[model samples]
Target: MSHEEIIKTTQHWLEQAVIGLNLCPFAKAVFVKNQIRFVVSDAKHLDGFLDDLDRELVFLAQAPADEVDTTLLIHPTLFPDFEIFNDVQALADDIVAEHELEGILQVASFHPDFQFADTEPNDIGNYTNRAPFPILHLLREDSIAKAVEAFPNPDVIFERNIETLQKLGIAGWMALGLQASQK
Candidate 1:
């Protein structure tokens, strides 16, 4: 699917969360454009960010796609830290192992130390100053199974996530953990 399609598809998924989260229309658009994976730090403000998608989020669609390499470059912003990402990645690996995936589902997240000033690697995706965190670009999927395998158990991850949002309020939620930020 094209980038627009991906954004739209992701929005559909977010819609389900809106019932409880009450996300604003614009925030929904921004989150999808930025490719912020499903997460809510402050259930209240989760919609706020959705209402105003940062310009950085919009560029995610324009990112170049890889033809031969199927690496999924995940920006660090997606998770709280490397440990969380590693757990998620391990979960993905488990899914792949269980499903017997073909092709590759390589992963990459944000490296706080990696600077844009450094020489660009041909294989790595570009980083945006606006969305300074990290991002995940699923390079390729031989089948739907491979693509589906990339995600972790949302119920498990978001269970505490929702509570955190409720307790922390919008500002608090944003500051607390790896809540989804569209920008």
Candidate 2:
């Protein structure tokens, strides 16, 4: 897909799923403030992707918190298989540590097929993390800490998300039009 379409689709998922479903309660604030950065990776290979990862890590680290609270580095075609994408997630973490961002910054991943461990492929709970494409979510630790503190019972967020998706069911999620993300 074209860059514009890729970005638009990601935004659509954010609107229809993340924000609409209240998957991540903290997301809406930054999203409305335009603090979420959507960057489509232009890497040609895994090695190149690592370079792109390094660049984004540095960018997020140096940028002011109010200007860019988070970043979604979307790579449309590099990781079609969830396993490969999952493995690369470890490397992403290593990069953050290498840059000495272990506590200050972190990386979370989301993909069309983001299956949680021990869950069936079609489990509704996995939908909590599913996104339109392979996404490396760069988050600020401070922001997370602050958000968690302000939110009531932050520990129950995961259980709440599972319950929410379970209530929505797979069919309901499909109705939301996120199946296109599986591409």
Candidate 3:
């Protein structure tokens, strides 16, 4: 499909499948100038499987719509499991497919120790490595070596994702709290 075609089709899928799937209680639509976002619920039906384009499309198609896109941020805690860790390759493939997307999607992942705001670099094992956008459950911030295995280098990965977002030019930060009922 042409770039325009891909974007239109993907947006359609997002509206029809992702939002419709109702996979999470918090699925909803988010409208940015150039992109649309889908806030996810605490559901794992399609974890680690979305690293491929086809799989991602399928997921977007199968996702439920009852929820609202409160804050479509991506984080590893959302998909915590060893299986997703082991199948990183497949997951990456699905993500690679997303490149077919005319524009880009921004996903977020945080390291476990990120909460330790006062901790020093040395005190922490090593958070020098860069991680992929939707951090794999297996990769952590402290291990640059492991992070490198996913990309050429952790720094490059960080630089690239950040740069990509900057280039997009229209960015917003939203925090959609998980409802108490989910717990």
Candidate 4:
């Protein structure tokens, strides 16, 4: 897909799955403020994708928080396998630590095939983290801290998300029309 198409699709997924379903209670605020940056990386290889990742991490770290609070680094063609994507996620963490951004920045991962351990692949709950493509969601630590502080019972977000998704079910998820094509 073209860059514009990729972005539009990702945004649609955000609107339909994340914000529409209230999976991330904190997403709507930044999204409505236009503080989320959607970056589509054209890299076809892992090393090249890491270069994109490094650039985005630096970009997010240096940009003013009010202007760019978070980033969804969308790579359409790389790491199609969820296991490989999970492994690459570790490299992303290492990059943050290497750049001394452990506290300043953190990475959250999402993929079309996101699955929690022991959960069935088609479980509705997995859709909580499912996006149209493999995404590295870069978030500011301070922002997360403040949001968590203001939100009550932050620990229950996961359980709540599972319950919400269970109510939605696989049929409901399919109704959103954002599921990535199965490989």
Which predicted model would earn the best lDDT?
A: 2
Candidate 4: C-alpha lDDT: 0.90
lDDT of 4 by residue, 1-183 (tens): 899999999999898888998888899999999999999998879999999999999999999999999999999888789999999899999999988999999999999999889987877778888888999999999999999998998999899999988888877887888774374
List the global CA lDDT of all models. Answer: 0.33, 0.91, 0.31, 0.90
The worst-scoring run of ten residues by lDDT in candidate 4 lies at: 174-183
By TM-score, how accurate is candidate 2?
0.96
Candidate 2 structure quality by residue, lDDT tens digits, 1-183: 889999999999999899999999999999999999999997889999999999999999999999999999999998989989999999999999999999999999998888889988888888888998999999999999999999988888899999998898878887988773342
Candidate 4 — which residues are off by over 4 angstroms?
180-183
Worst 10 residues of 2 by lDDT: 174-183
Off by over 4 Å in 1: 1-78, 111-131, 141-183
The better-scoring model by TM-score among 2 and 3 is: 2
Q: lDDT of candidate 3 vs native?
A: 0.31
Q: Report clashes for each candidate as comma-separated counts.
A: 16, 0, 25, 0
True-structure RMSD for candidate 1: 18.1
Q: Quantify how close model 4 is to the true structure by its C-alpha RMSD in Å.
A: 1.2
Give the residue spans of candidate 3 off by over 4 A.
Answer: 1-40, 47-72, 75-78, 81-93, 102-125, 128-183
lDDT of 3 by residue, 8-87 (tens): 44344334323432221112323332223332223354553353323334343334422222122233344444234335
How far out, in Å, is residue 173 in model 4?
Answer: 0.9
lDDT of 1 by residue, 1-183 (tens): 444543443344344433224322223433444434422212133233222222212332233322122222323233545345445444444444443432433333333222233434211121111122323333234322433455454334335543534554535423422233332
Model 2: runs farther than 4 Å from truth?
180-183
